[model samples]
Target chain A: MSTIANYGEVQRALQTDTEQILAQIPVSPVTLSMPMDGAGPRICASVKRDDTSRVPASVNVVLDGNPVEIVVEAVGDYQDFKAL
Target chain B: MMVNEGSEGRGGDAEHFSRLFEWLNTNADRLLDDPATNLVAVGIGKKSAGRIDDDSPFCITGFVEKKLSEKEIASRSMSLFADAAAAVSNVGQPKSLDFEIDVIETGSRFRARPGLQFPAAQRGLRGGAAPTLDLQKRFETIRKGIGITNPHRSYPASLSVGTLGFFVRDEGGTTFLVSNNHVIADENKARKGDSIVQPGTLDLTQSELNLMPTLAKLRAQLEIAKLSAFVDIHFHNPQAIPFNEVDCAAAEILSDKRDFSEIARIGLGGDLSGVATPFTIDPVTGEVTGLTRVYKAGRTTGWTEGEVTQLAVVTDVRYGAGLARFRNQLGIAASPDNTGPFSRAGDSGSAIVNARQELVGLLFAGSEMQTLANPIQPVLDALSGALGAKALTVI
Candidate 1:
């Protein structure tokens, strides 16, 4: 079970495992964000749903002796608010 | 059906006629609902020519959909005369008080009659005239979280709408409405001194469609309504700045000095102070230190709540043919308790506030699931440089 008590572990994942994963991804649009779902500051990478590339549903990156979770979501492109 | 209190001698008769007018107007709804009456419209008018003497010419006129035969009229109890006579007698007036009901055949369907000055006989009575309301003043009072837009190109053509984000004041105390450049400035299309209409162009079009019969007339009325230009917008698109910091503009409100300074539909149990300041962010973590939840009152959504789902987000947003890239933006997802999405199309330029009602960001873009806002402090700083204000502070 992952708890929010490991801020340092999450930071380590962001600097190391998250960066390496982003650098290797072939998708055109990918963003890193933090979702507060009681799991504290965790990384969520949103990718465009239309892309043919594949993304892992969830990845646990180990920092020191602790594991941090990174979530990937497939979403539609963002457009400015002009009624279509 | 038109009810007229024919032109009678002025004296005690005036009160009688006034009473007659009041009765007819009060029963208008009942008259319309009764199929026997066959009344399509009601108003005060002169009695039919030569039907009555000039001294007593005014009567209550009822425009029937069609001319009914005497037999049909009688069968339907379409007797305004007997009704008025009975009404006068009820009030202890002389039974001889001869008010009239002139049933005319319009021979056409009567829709809403905007042309009719006083559609109801009651409107012609004393104390009937309402105080002349400055409708334009109501429209010109630009407040935060309401619909507003600019007329960049032509009438009814280039009518795009968005929300007024919030209000800001310069060091000199001049108040201005802060919204997206796409909203007040039309994404770099509108010029200085261009009209920024409230309720937006779409709302104006819908209003005209309901009131005006013809498209040409609607366009004309829209042209007159263009006078709702509430602010003189100042914005700039610097080709030098690599990436846009905020999709924001400041428009100095041009209306009279009446404190229009308020946000719509939010108090948060005394959390709001009529002033909005952004939340502080951690420099190293790039996280809004204490901001957990957010809220907004927008043109479309009215009021909504969401959780901070993303921070320091860099996304490429589509703006018609061009794409403007924004960085360091806050992303929000609809709160679990919200009934619908956090934001919608017309919700752009809404001020995103935190649980404490502190201003957090200026919402500019979004998808069905996520809403994006430019952090508030950066938006203020950007507006300051563009509008040449020493500093801009939310009021």
Candidate 2:
């Protein structure tokens, strides 16, 4: 019985890990460029995610040493995860 | 006489017996009806009640739910309540008993509570819980490093003030010191004969070389190398640094007694020969682009650096005729540091330079990241006109 319980616990842990990894992936939908007053143009990119129930994830876009922009999106549905 | 005594005795006995019988009748009825009444009577008999006299040793055990105004409840009463709560409990029956007292919550409003202890004096009253002389003493060491006379009067480390100098020539050929219009142009225009003092140190006793060694060296090198052969070297008096507008100004030499030779020193870092070092300036538009490191020396924080952030930022500045627009001006923004903005409050009119210490712009207005500096070309032109000298190049 103990071994059976341990197997269930392991499966749940694996499921949680998979969910976290899936949440990190984003699907970008649109991109916009905004000009700064004195600085160069700032680019903003939007992404769609699969897990809509969880908080959105953000990714940093860096080119060379300077920071470019951050792309963020929320996860949507189980079908989207399956498609991924 | 025998009859009289016997009669009086009988009368006294009768009166006593009568009183006892009345008490027994009244108590007997109450005791028979309610067992609690008997306990209350016994308790009352044990306690000496009436009004607690001044001399009486009264040990008040239970709290009083008085329907009195909070004003009526003196500080002494509040203290008594606090003491009572802290004292040993007396309700032997083990049942929880609550006492309520009405207090003023808001204007004309009252609130009641059960078993409420009296409030102590306010926390800040009587210098309670406040930093005393001990705190001042503790920070005395830190205060000395910042040159603060008193810790209590010490301002935050972030605040700073700086001063810059400018010169203006009058019709009499006497070159007078002039700063920003805002500085000298008060309600009444700053006229000739108006007393002007240098903002910071006025002591000329110290060696001008040691005071600004870098500037002195630069001037010496320039004069020796005959760098002034190409550009005119004019000296002037320092004026009051303004708070607003472009911090630009010039001063007149009070006497030729000043060491003009020190003004031409290049190796000392006051050299204007490198003032025209070329940076990325848009040929057609005159807009500054890309990155160029700039430096500035001021009366306050001394020398600091930043990069030119923008060019031709239109800002309205207050002049004699209300607000006037200035265009195509240079704006240099400095990187964040422990001391902040390559410039601060008192750094107005400081000459902004580059890594080579070339004259780049003039330090004026800035807060933290955002700083604005005026290009040196217009300033040099103005100074040249005032000093009766040919215009020098400032890229």
DockQ (Cα-based) per candidate? Answer: 0.15, 0.01
Best by lDDT: 1
lDDT of 1 by residue, B151-232 (tens): 6564455556688777767888777778887777666666776656565666664655457544354433332122111222
After superposition, candidate 2 runs with Cα above 4 Å error: A1-84, B1-162, B165-179, B184-188, B192-195, B199-247, B256-260, B266-270, B277-291, B317-324, B336-338, B385-395
Q: Write candidate 2's Cα lDDT for B50-89 as tens digits.
A: 3333222222122233333345545334422322222223
Q: Kindly report the root-mean-square deviation of model 2 from the true structure over all alpha carbons.
A: 32.0
Error of 1 at A23 (Å): 5.9
Chain A TM-score values, per prediction: 0.49, 0.25
State each model's C-alpha RMSD to the native.
Answer: 14.2, 32.0
Kindly report the docking quality category of candidate 2: incorrect
